[model samples]
Target: MQFHIPAGVGEGMQLTVSGKGNTLGRHGGINCDLLVVIQEEKHPELERDGNDPIYNLNISIPDAILSNTTEIPTAEGRAKIK
Candidate 1:
C-alpha cells in the first residue's frame, strides 16, 4: 500500500485512516480500527544507529589502495566522499 507519510513521522508513530480497516457490520459498527506495524528491512549498504545513518561502503581493491573518492547514495541523493 502506498501511504504518504506526513512530515515529522518517526518510529512507533501511529497513522490512522478512518473507514480503511476491516468491516464490523455484524457488531453494528460501520467502522473498524486498522492497526499497522512498522518493521525495518535490512539494507545492503546502510544501517541505522539511533537517529544517525551508518553507511557500509565496499570499495574495489584498486580504489581503496589509491584512496579515491566514492559516490554514495543517501536519502537526498548521491554524494561524493573521500
Candidate 2:
C-alpha cells in the first residue's frame, strides 16, 4: 500500500486525523481522537542537536598536526573538508 506524506513534514511534527479513535461506552455515543506519536530513529553516523546534525570525525596524530583534506560522510553525501 502507498502512503502519502506531506512535503512540509519534518521531525517532531505531528498530524491529527479527527474521529479515528475508539468510542466511549457500549453505545458509541462519544468518539475520541487518535493520539498519534511520531518518533525518529537515531542515525548511526550523526547526532542531533536541536534541528542541526553533528558529525564526529577521528583523525590520526599525524593528520591532525599536518594540513590535509579528508572526505567525510554527511546526511547529504560525502564531503571533502580541509
Candidate 3:
C-alpha cells in the first residue's frame, strides 16, 4: 500500500498513519510504522571536530488491524474481477 503524507511537516509535527481494508464484507484497518528524522544546521566549529548532527526517530504502528462484522468484497465491485 502507498501513503500520501501531508506537506509542512517540519521540526515538531505529529505523524500518524491509518487505513482500512475489506474482505468478504468484513472491514479491517492497520496502523503503519513510521520514522522521523531531523537535520541540524551546519556549523563551522562542528566541522573542525569531525562531528555531524542528525536526529534519529523510531515509531511503531498503534494498531495492526481492525475487524468489522459487515461482509465486503476484497476487490471493488465496480471493476471487473481479474
Prediction-by-prediction clash tally: 0, 0, 5
lDDT of 2 at 78: 84
Q: Local distance difference test, per candidate?
A: 0.72, 0.72, 0.36
Candidates 2 and 3 compared by lDDT, better number: 2
Which residue runs of candidate 2 sit more than 4 Å off their true CA positions? Answer: 1-12, 16-37
- Residue-level lDDT of model 3, residues 23-51, one tens digit each, is 23336444344543434344332221223
Model 1 scores a C-alpha lDDT of 0.72
**Model 1 misses residue 62 by how many Å?**
14
- Residue range 7-34, candidate 2, lDDT tens digits: 5355677766566778878986787776
Q: Could you tell me the lDDT of residue 73 within candidate 2?
A: 74
- lDDT tens digits, residue span 1-82, model 1: 5556675455677877667688887866777656665555656677777767788778899998888998997766689987
Model 1 regions more than 4 Å off: 6-14, 56-68
Name the 10 consecutive residues with the lowest summed lDDT in model 2. 1-10
lDDT preference between candidates 1 and 3, better one: 1
State the displacement of the C-alpha of residue 11, model 1, in Å, after optimal TM-score superposition.
Answer: 6.7
Give, for candidate 3, the lowest lDDT window spanning 10 residues.
73-82
